[model samples]
Every structure is written in C-alpha cells, then in structure tokens.
Target: MTRAKIAKTLLTLPLLSAQLLACQPADGQNPAQPGQPGSLKTLSAPSAAELQSLRSSELPEANTRFALAFFGDLLNETPRENVFISPLSLSIALSMLYQGASGETRQEIADALRYSGLSEAEINAGNLTLRKRLQNSGKGVTVQIANALWGKAGLSFNAGFLSRNQAFYDARLEALDFGSATAVARINQWASDNTNGLIPKVIEEIDPMTILILMNAIYFKGDWSEPFEASQTQERSFYKADGTTLEHPMMQRYDKFRYTNNTDAGFEAVSLPYGEAEETEMILLLPHAGKDLASLRDQLTPENWQSWLSSLRSRDGSVTLPKFKLKTERQLNDTLRRLGMVKAFSEAEAEFDSLLDNSPLKAYVSEVKQDAFIDVNEKGTEAAAVTTITVGATSIQLPQEPFEMVLDRPFLYAIYDRATESLLFMGALNSPEL
Candidate 1:
C-alpha cells in the first residue's frame, strides 16, 4: 500500500478513561499526589544501564525523530496550562511511538509528541484506529504501543490483565466488513467506564468498514502550596485579539515562584512546579505590557523557545492571572500525514508483520482527532487530554532571582524533564477561553 492509501484508511476509531490511582514516581523519582494528573511515569523509569542501552541502540530512532517533530509543533501551539504538566504525559505517549516503529523514526516521534501540549484524551480518541491495529496484532506490540500512546499524550495509563489477554494476542483483521455499531458502543462504554464517566457518549457508532480505533482520558487535581486567597480573586477586564474585552475571574497571589524576564521579547515568564521538581509540573509566560498573545505566538520557534527560557531573570513581583477552564476537540488526521508519516497510511507501503499473521495489509489513517480540557485556578491545575497519532526544544538559563507571575497577554509555555532536558509538552495560548 502507498503512504497515501494507508493514511486514507486510518480515519475511523473510538473513546476513553480509567481508574484514578494516585501515581508514585518509579525509581525514586518524585511522586505526584492524586490531583497532579500529568505526573505519571516516563518510559517506565528505565534503569541507568537500560537508559544507556536505549541511548546506544540504533532502533527506535525514526520514532524518536517523529516524536520531537510532533512535540515542537505542539509546544509552538499549545496553551500555557498544558505546558507545565507534560513530562509524564510525554513518557506514556512515547511508549505508543515504540509500537511498530524503530530507529531514528521512533526517537524523533517520541521527542516531538512527548511534550506537544496535546491532552491524553485527545490523543487517544484520535488514534483509536492505530490503537486497534496494534491491539489486534496478536503481538507484544500492543502493550508497548498502548503504553507509549497514552504516556506521551498526557493520559494516565496502567498495564493490566485487560491489555494482556491472550485473546487480544490472537486477534486479526478477520476482514473489515463487520457491523461496527455494536463494537463502537462497546468501545464507548469502555471509555465511559475507564474515565469513571468523566467522558460520556464517546463514539456515536462505528460505521461499517471501520479501520481503527484510538482513545484516551486523564483526571488530575492539585492545590497550590500557597493558593491565591479566595478574597484575591476578582472580576477583571481582559483584552481580546479584537479590540474587545470581557470580565473574567482573575486569581491573584504574591507567593514565591520560579520566574524570569526577557527584555529581548519584552516578556516575563513564571514556572510553578506541580509538586516537588520530580512530580508533574506547570509553567506560565506573560508578555510585557502592550504585547498581544498572537504576536508572541508568531515569534515562537525552537531557537527562540530556548532563548526565552535562557533569558529568565527572576525578581520578586506581583502576579495575577485569570482563573479559567477550557475544553476543545479537533480532527487532525490530515494534519499528521501532512507532517510526514506517509508510509504508515499508504496501502502500497503499509507493512504489519508486527500487527498481523504475515498477512499483507492495506491501511491508511482515515482520521485523527484530539480533545483537550484544562482548568487553572488559585489552587493549581486539573486537566485531561487525548490525541491519536495512528500514523503520526532548547532552553536558556538566566541570573537567579525571584520573579513575578503576571499573565496579561498570551504567552508560550512548556513542560520538560528537568533531568534530560527533554520537553514533554510545549505550546502557546492566545486565548484561554478557547
């Protein structure tokens, strides 16, 4: 199958959720409380030797490259809230990238998607078809794929009997003509159950000849060590891109935080870790007065991203930001293939010895979708994200000093692994209302 044909076949799929178990960091890493959702695990906490082995291995490079590319675009596009809670999410997401991909391909993809500010729910819902492909592959790839997909996309995932079933190991593409309505319903039920009803009515129904299904969900809650006093929250006017403004509940706090200022971009950035440094994290960027968010986003790039971080000059200052929550969903299949995952979707080039019993398969991503939800308040952050791939940052340091947190305009943000300097989530938010 050609890449074009394979992509054409990947558009169909499913929904998400699971139990809300508090995550403990593996291997002495920081463990986040139940409320800090993005603080899951990363790459299953590889041992030093194992990490070294993975680093030296020639396999998974393609996947890694793809991951980095995807994440770069995401960081460049996401809101500030999602950026802080990205590491654990990216780790789980990379596990999916590990699925049938290898060499530079896997690494690139892992690097990119791991921190691309995409929500776990959006990632999963959109990639169900790809998930279905691996789930039905009858190979060990299913666990690996599921882990990577969920981890990187900001979903909290745990491997268990359901994923380890022998029946799943023996499954095949018996032909794509089965009535998928029932299958779709069952999948939707699974999603509702997994999410504990956080997400309702996932897929309306599966149309006949459904090619794949991917789904995801996450639940997080956290309180700031020093939350903005309720008394400090007040209605304030917020200017929009248009010459319009709206009153919003703006939260204010004078607590100590990680902050910086960049004279070059005329902006100030603040970082507030969710828990300890090892747990999930969050960061916010505020442009200097008089600059709009769209302008900041337009100036964002990998190099500038690093420069922005490097330019941080922390100094104590008052901080105020709107207390808000937002949710959004989008279809992204075309966007992915357009980014360069041609082979996975082409009927002429699709190969799935990893997914089938050596049967020649014609697969193409039919669609890719994403659903993202987030809330920012004086307490902290709570969010859920889902994205489906199916087929498809630098930093700077500045003088150390206390900094202020003020978000008057749109700004860029990122979530990263403090240890590896790997970015797990990156994006810019021009409008919190979206």
Candidate 2:
C-alpha cells in the first residue's frame, strides 16, 4: 500500500459589511486605481526574549471553550460527508483580524469565538504560545503553521493592526493589485506551497471590491511510534452507515495503548502516539453497536472531552482499522453568522475602523473558506488544513483489557498535540475512500 500524504489550504474575502459612508478624500489623496501595484512593508520582528515570554504565557480557558463550541456548531451544520477542520488555523486567522475590530463588531467576534474572559492582548499572546507549541517537533514528526495578510497596495491600513499580527502571529504582509490576474495566482501559489500541494488552489478569483485577505495554513506529518506492519494488511469487510459492505485494506496491530471503554458515553477510544517523542497522538473513537455517531458527538463538550482524556488507561490490546483518505472543502459564512457573528457580516453595523486610516472605509468579513486533506495507512498519518478569512466591503480510541477493537464501520477521530492538549485536527470517517 502507498504511504499516506496529506495537505490543505484556505482563502477568504469580504462579501459585504457596514453601509458605505461617503467621505471626501484627504487633500492630495486619490482613490485606488484598478490594477495599480501597492507598496509592501514588513513589520518589525519580535525578539527572542519577547517570543519566549509569550511562550511562557498561559492560554485562557476561553480559547478552549470556543474551539469545542465551534466544532459542535460546524458538526451541526454539516451532518453528512466527511468533516475535517483545523480549529487552530481558524482561530489564529480570527485572532489576527480581532486586532482591528472594535465595539459591537469586536463583541460579536469575541462571543462567537468564546473570547469572553480574555482581553485582546491576552488572546494574542495566547495564540503566539499556541502557534509555537504546535510547531515544535520531535524526531519523525513535522508540524508547521504559516499566516499572511494580503491587501490592496494603495490602501492605508492601521499600523497597530499590521504590527500586532506580525509580532504575535508572525503574519507576512504583502500588497497586491487585486484587480490583476496574477494576484490570484500568487495567493493560490502560496497556499499550494504551504500545504505541500495537497490543496493547489484556494480561491477561484478575487472579488473586484476586495481590499484584504487573511490566511492561516497548518501542515502535520508523523510516523506512528509503532508502525503497523504492511504485510499484515488484509481485505476485510467494512460496514457502512447504509448497511452496505465493502472490502477494505484493514491494518492490524497488537500493542499496549492508552484506552478507555465509556459505557455511559456509548463508545470506546484508543490513543496512538506518533514519533519517538510521543508528543502527538491520533485518537479513534468507535461507537457501540446500535449507537449513532451523532449521539456521541452531542456529548462532546469540553468537560466531557477532558473527562475522557483523564479517564484513559493503559491496556494491552489488538486494533484493526481500515486505511482511509479524505479531502473536504467547506464554506463557513452561514455557520459563523449563526454563531452570533451577525453584525460582522452586516454592511451597516460592522466595525473595523482600526484597520484603515479612512474611517468611512469600514471593512467587514464576507467569506470564509477551508480545504483539508488527510491520509492514514500502516506507516503513519499526514494531514493539512488551510483557512482564509476574506473582507471586501464590510463584512479516538480506546483500549481495554487485552481487548480486540475492530473498526469495521464509521468512527470519529482526532489528531491532538499532547504537549498542550490541543486538538489540531478532527473528523468523522464515514467511508474509507472519500
């Protein structure tokens, strides 16, 4: 069987935001002309000491709460098809944009993102720590994160907004002629390169009135600490949700793993470590026979997630899992709106005055796009995801006593960073090939 290779990318642009307010151009100032190239300015880099200090700072519980809640909402929205998302990528993009938000706009984003208790500064600092922690690697495992901001060249953006993202998120800054065909090519090329080509194109085209785009890309590759022997793979029957059965290449292994059987939760779980350091793991959760995956998901609150992790125990067991791969793309506009971020998409109410010197040129989020890919096989697991937040006008696992767990049906899974207890990637495997 071929080794797994995964990658993902995302792109976003404002759809519509606050009502346009007429204001006279400043003396000697002119409107941005279409196809005109703009200037590029890089923000001052943070010092080693500064980065270290931020790293030592603790992430607030609000961030964790927001992530779990957001996942629940997304699951509710997309009940079918394989769903895979990188909460870290999405949060980082929104946190960067949060630097420029104010008033009700800021409140809407804060409530939707579960930033209730943390100040803007605290959130930014926490993200710096989160990003660095995720990128830290041990032998045989690679985790990378990249952030960028592309804006119309002639437009004047707030200095603080640019500097804050650069210092905290390490976001790259670029000025592009959005009206130029080459602009889209350049942005998509960046996405492709960052995701190792798993997602070659993130955007079909840039909207004419678009002023800026914020993006985050995360890529992860890891070899299981105990790689499953490929020669042992055999064609086995895998039952689908529809009651049909298909022959799948099932990989098997007998080893000691952190596992749990939650009778109350109605599922079993197992955690498989990656790399020699074992700083990362893939957790698989299989529902009991006759139980629905949705029922288990509904119980996945932050409190329950923590309880499950804490409850996991070491057990010698045998595991049989199908080799699978998945690629998914999602539009999150309605989802975010439904999550209490309505004003941010309203042209009349959105507030982003901090992003531009032209007060009347308020910006609002328009679209949010994400593309993800993942592959799992005998050697290991590799996954990537990209998230883009556009603005134009306003807007697993288990274990048991020498127990045998054969995954012959749909299951839920997660890629987690052990060092920080971060959920890097999550999905439901409804089919082996999707």
Candidate 3:
C-alpha cells in the first residue's frame, strides 16, 4: 500500500488587471488599461525591535479577525458554497503592498484588512514574527513561504518601500519584461515550486495594463498526530447545500481532543492536531442542524472567536470528516471594495505614490485574485492557496462531554498554528467532493 500524504496549503499573491476590474458591484468587473512599470531600490528593513516587542498574542488575533471578515462577506455572496482562505499569507502580501500606499488609499486598505490599532511598524513586525514562528513549527510538519515581486522592466519604485517588504516579507524583488512570455513562465514556476506543484500557473496572460505582479506563496504540510484508521472510512450521508445528499467517504475517529460546545452560538468545535508536538491543528466547527453556516458567519467576531477557543476543554469525542478535494478560483476586486478598501481600486483616487520614484507613475490596485486547493482523508490533510495580487490588486470551537461532531453538513474549519496563534488556512464547507 502507498503511504498517505500530509496536509499542505499555499498562499499566493498575484495581481493583474485587463482593465482595472470594476470596483462597484453594480458596474460588474471591467478591466482597466495597464498602468506604468516600476523597478525596486533598497532601504533599511523594518525595525527588529518592533518585531521583538510584538511577540504577543494580539497580532495573530488581528490576522484572524481580518480572515473572518473576508469569510463573512464571502458567505453573504454565496451562502451555500465552499470557501477556504489563508489569512497569514494574504496579510503578509498586503502588508508588503501597504508600504507603498498613501493617504486615504492606505487607510482604506488598512480598514479593509482590519489593521486598526496597529501601527505600520507593528503590522510589518508582527507579520515578520509570524513567518518566523510558523515556518519551523513542529516535527513531521512542513510549512514553506516564498515571496517575489515582478515589475515592468523600466518602471521605478521607492527604495524604502522595496526594502521594507524585502526585509519583512522576504520577498525577491525583480523587474521583469512583462511583455515577454518568459516572465510569465518564471512567475508561474515560482508559484509551482513553492506550492509543491499544486498550482502550476497563476496568470494565463499578462494584461498590458498590468504594471506589477506581487507574489507570496505559502505551502504547508501536516500529518494527523492521531491518524484516523483507514478501515473506518466508508460511504456516508453528507448533506449538501442544495438540499441533496451525497454518499461520500467519511473518515471516522474516536479519541480525546480539545473540544467545546457553544450552546449560545449553536455550534460545536474540535481541534485535531498534526505532527508530534501538536503545535498546529485543524479546528473544525460544526454548526447545529438548524443554524447552518449563515448563522456562524454573523456570529464570527474576534471577541467571539477568542471566547470559543478559550472555552475548549479536552474530552472524549468522535469526529467524522468527509474525505474530499476541491479547487477554487476567485477574482476579489468587488469583495475588497465592500470591505472598506475602495480608494485603492479607484482610478481617480487611488494612491500608490510610495511605489514611484521620479517617474510619472501612478497606480491603483487593479485586481486581486486567489486560487486555493485542499484534500482530506484518513491520513491527514493537504492544501495550497495562492492569492495573486495584480497590484491590481490588489473560528473556534468547543465541545466536550463525549461530543459526537460530524461534518455531515455545512461547517467551518481552520488550520491554526498554536505556537503563534496564526491561522494558516480557514474555510466554510457547504459542499464536499464525492
């Protein structure tokens, strides 16, 4: 028999726009003409002292808060669909872009990312600490991060702006000939290598208006610390969002786990660990039959999430997770606007002066796109996420008392790093692969 693969996830930032995509929902997605190009210069890194000072729990919580906000809006738009996102990766990528934004544009992006109460230094430092803490998390687990900047050959960029991202985010800055096919292949190659080949390509063709491409790819692999018995896996009833039932392979496990039951919120959650140290876990929240994901979306706030997590106590429990695999591609222009990041996408008001040196270059986030993949079974979980920022672009649980939590219907899940309280990946699953 072949050995089972571990869980993996990739977070990518790919920014590109045909014509700046529409910022308004009613207007729909309309591409904008490509803007100017840019090349990087260097400055000093974000303060190391800043990173040291924020070795606290607050930063990870903020990153998670932002992810939940994004999830809520996604649920609002497609209440019955499946969704999985990596907050840590996107936060790092956007925080890099934040260095180049100014005025209302900067503030709007911050608000949309839930970056309030955080100074720019704190944001950069916090992200830097997170990357360090999570990369070498636990034995038997692998978490990889890769960052790169692709710009038009002749474009100009601020020295300090490039330096901060390169230092804090570990991004490789390069001025590529966007007009050449080789540039596309190299960028895609970087994505593929970083994600372990999960996502081979990000952009099919570079839009001429595409001024810059910023990429951040995160790949994570983890095996279940307590592996489920493959023999226990069998076809079981999985309730679908469209009022149908699927006979999917449901892997069953009965053991002691950190669990909590939120009676008031009408949901139960359990944390399944990976690797020997159990530093990373998959926190699964199964909503009550009547409540569904919609109920959880409205209830998911930073305060509430922390409360749910705190409430978890170890106890005997049984979890039945569907063995499934899925891939999703999304253009995030409008959703971002709705989240208070409007000015960055506006052609008239957008401000990215920090990204320019002496050239007559002005750029706005054209489009932000993400492609994600996940697989789960008896062995463990494997997943990858890529959030390409085309400068274009640019949950908890509970349960105990011998709980019986089965993800037979819509539920929420997040791959969390306990060492840093960082959420590498999270999602609402309404449908699973049969």
lDDT of 1 by residue, 22-90 (tens): 111123211111221111222233355544443344322322334344444444454332322222233
Q: Point out the higher-scoring one by TM-score: 1 or 2.
A: 2
Q: Go through the candidates in order and give each one's C-alpha lDDT.
A: 0.39, 0.69, 0.70
TM-score of each: 0.61, 0.86, 0.86
Residues 163-236, model 3: lDDT tens digits: 78677777645666677899788777777777788778888878776666777777777899999999999887
Off by over 4 Å in 1: 1-98, 101-182, 193-197, 216-219, 276-279, 298-307, 310-314, 347-349, 389-405, 415-417, 420-427
Q: Model 3, which residues run further than 4 Å from truth? A: 1-52, 392-401
For candidate 1, give the lDDT of residue 304: 67
Q: Compared with the true structure, what per-residue lDDT tens digits does model 2 show for residues 77-103? A: 655446777776777777777878889
lDDT score, candidate 2? 0.69
The per-prediction CA RMSD against the true structure, in angstroms, equals: 14.2, 6.5, 7.6
**Comparing candidate 1 with candidate 3, which one achieves the higher lDDT?**
3
Worst 10 residues of 1 by lDDT: 2-11
Q: Candidate 2: where are CA atoms >4 Å away?
A: 1-60, 394-400
